[model samples]
Target: MSDLYIGLMSGTSLDGVDGVLVDFSSVQPRVLSHATQGFDDRFRAELLQLNTSGPDELHRAALAANELARVYALVVKRLLETTGTQPAQVRAVGAHGQTVRHRPQQFDGTGYTLQLNQPGLLAELCGMDVVADFRSRDVAAGGQGAPLVPPFHQALFGQLPGVTAVLNIGGISNLSLLNASGAGSLIGFDCGPGNALMDAWSQTHTRQAFDAEGRWAAAGTVHAGLLQSLLSEPFLALPAPKSTGRDLFNGPWLQAHLQSFAHVSAQDVQATLTELTAQACADSLLKQAPDCKRLIVCGGGALNTHLMSRLRALLPGCDVASSAVHGLPPLQVEATAFAWLARQCLERQTGSVQSVTGARGARILGAIYPA
Candidate 1:
């Protein structure tokens, strides 16, 4: 029997899915292989539209969920083919379906989050046991069903003495701090905007999906006015146990911040947004985990060269680097995390800590769909 689990992650950016075949046969699990599968243009647009109020809500979301499963099935096929592994040999798949809405605080009750996925479809399509819906349980338990990767960071970086922080710069930025083998204070929360605002601006101006290595931002100067205004967002001051997404920091939100600075150039806005992300992350790390020695960045934002420079500039004396510096590629860490989460669920282990998500307590996350 192969103790293998595949993790499929499509982050808040509405980006493609990242699939990783993970082997937990040893003390430290290993990513046997990693592959990325893209969503078609229609599906991407559909998901983006679903982010806000739209027509035909029930029908559209259901269609999008089914489509998400189809795309995920493609990822599974690619992962198994590339690794020469059979679906039957794999244990389970941890599918963090695309998160459309992550509102952990609702007026009526604790709160809720929704990830567009069809695990039953995935299990049927991929011929493997599927584990997904990893966030709802934490929310049901009165926790912000966000920043689910911190424990994985703790497990991965736990043995490295001193305070170690893992910053995942996806659509939104989140910080996961671990003090070496659970030795000290652990903190995890969404820092602020990562690529979402920047990408939206880039797409609007350049017609490109992203700002390729943060080149545009590097070419521009950070407008202090805009940066200050952006920094003034209330989410930043709320302290830990808080999380946010594009719902609050999208393009319109950025535009609202920029309205006062009409003369600011587009590139400058990009630069300021980039600064916003770096500053929020750095400030949170310095304040929350003062003794943090090593900062490892993962997600698509880590690949942004200029963003890395900004982080290093803000965080002097802290060895700022990508997750690749440690071993796992920046893009693969989250997907691999889901794979580990699947293992946790199957073993009845708690995947989240109360301190991180403000959950009532640790609980096994994700729903299992038998093959």
Candidate 2:
């Protein structure tokens, strides 16, 4: 009686689309198959531009959403093929569409978060029910409408006796501190830049998408003064139960901080960005979960060797390791969490934690589409 769900995620990184097939019957959802499809450079550029452009940007967003829907359909088809699961056998697909504009609070007092996913079109194309629009409900409930993975973390890895910090380093980084009582109490927030700064710096310098295992960063020295300046960002000091995305950690932010550092070596900047992520993450964890001895790292940043080494240096007493060490692959954890959220949607269960998202109370997240 296991249900198969396809969870599609396009994160803050705007790198690509990750579609995961998961089986939800037991405590831990089983990942059946996964596929990642990279977005074309043209689409990426358009997306980046739309993030800051004016009302005319809506046209670009529409184009991007159409393109993304096609990619989602393709990924769903490939996932079904790879898993040997027919479309009829699958319950539904959870589509976390591309987040174009997430203005949780507007100057006009209208709070809205936009995740540009044409779920109806996706459902029509994929021939399956699509659950999307997951963030609006939480915002309506007076929540931050982000860092929605903590409840999933609790479901997947909350067995330890003491506080455990689950750090997810996607384009943005967020941490969830799970109290040891096994009562599912948690606190979470976006720590500052993760791979976003490093990736932007690398691309600006070497035309590379990323540092690749943080090799380029490992070759350089961390600029301590620059790192401190980066750390001084107001967002880093923001209290918990908060969240952020590329809106805060994009190229312009980096450039503003660059100042005279434009003369610095690209490698040095890369190293400093790496250190920034590690330090910001560790600082957040230490402040919130001072007694936490176990830090579980997940997402793309977990694979960055240089970043991991820096994190290990910053948190000397904590046992820092990838979620893979605890049975979850770094790259697939977020996708899998979305799959779990899909399961929650199906069961009419709450997928968000009030303690994490500042929601008034727990509520079932996402709008469902019948197959």
Candidate 3:
């Protein structure tokens, strides 16, 4: 056979879930079908609320996870229908639940990360073996339990010459420095905020979900002082093996920084947020992988024209482009990676990179929920 797998991802942005049906029969995996489902305003707000503490959180999270599983199941249905594939045909469905809080290696030494998901529900709904919770294993092993796409990037794009880096700009931004020359040949870490901050800012001002194509940000001017203030975040200066989410860079974090820049216009603040994401990614690459030549940008941020332009301006020497040019579209990259991860789990192979997540060693990530 044919090695068919389905991958589902609802990332930090909290915007929606992306699912992909991929065939990995040959050496090169191909996306046979793709589907997406966006969370309504109310549901999105609830998910964001669960990011912090609230009344009956345990109960609320469970219900939310069930609802999320339903959404994933819907996407799975679409993918299978589009490709005329059966549940039994797919080896497994890799589901990355919504990450509400990510604070690995914090309190009590071995900190925890949470990705709310009902793998069993998903398995039952989709009638396929489901692989979920692909992070806790790494955290338990003294790793960050994040930025899990580096190894996938290496496997997919390692053929490129020179020091190639893949920048995945989701709700949070991360870098995967692949095929390096000397020590630290493969490095990956959470750089900084991606569209999460910008999306929040836009919603606050314009009541829009996100700044489409970054037009709102492009129309405004970057406030140098605010940009510098955002850059001063200590997390950005930290070494690799670090990951972050709404736990640190959430609304409170942005509001705290804006307390001093109260007079700043909303549009200017939006511009500054965009620049912050671009700067953080650029700074990380410069510091960690200075020799990086080709930078493949993926995730939702790849579609932001203004952000992409800023990255190009910030990193003059490096060639920046979306993963689409490399045959994988922006949204499909992560989903495909999860499909690959599902294959890894089924084969009893290592799915995470020790160097990337700072895990003790390579581990077969994810828990399988059999149908």
lDDT per residue as tens, model 1, 254-281: 7787789999998988898899999999
Give lDDT for model 2: 0.85
Kindly report which residue pairs in candidate 2 clash with one another.
none
By lDDT, the best candidate is 3
Worst 10 residues of 1 by lDDT: 178-187
Candidate 3 matches the true fold with a TM-score of 0.98
Question: Model 3, 109-168: lDDT tens per residue?
Answer: 899999999999998898999999999999999999988999999889887878899999
Those runs of model 2 whose alpha carbons end farther than 4 Å from true positions after fitting are: 180-182
TM-score each candidate. Answer: 0.98, 0.96, 0.98
Evaluated at residue 251, the lDDT of candidate 1 is 69
Number of the top TM-score candidate: 3
Flag clash pairs in model 3: none
RMSD per candidate (Å) reads 1.3, 1.5, 1.1
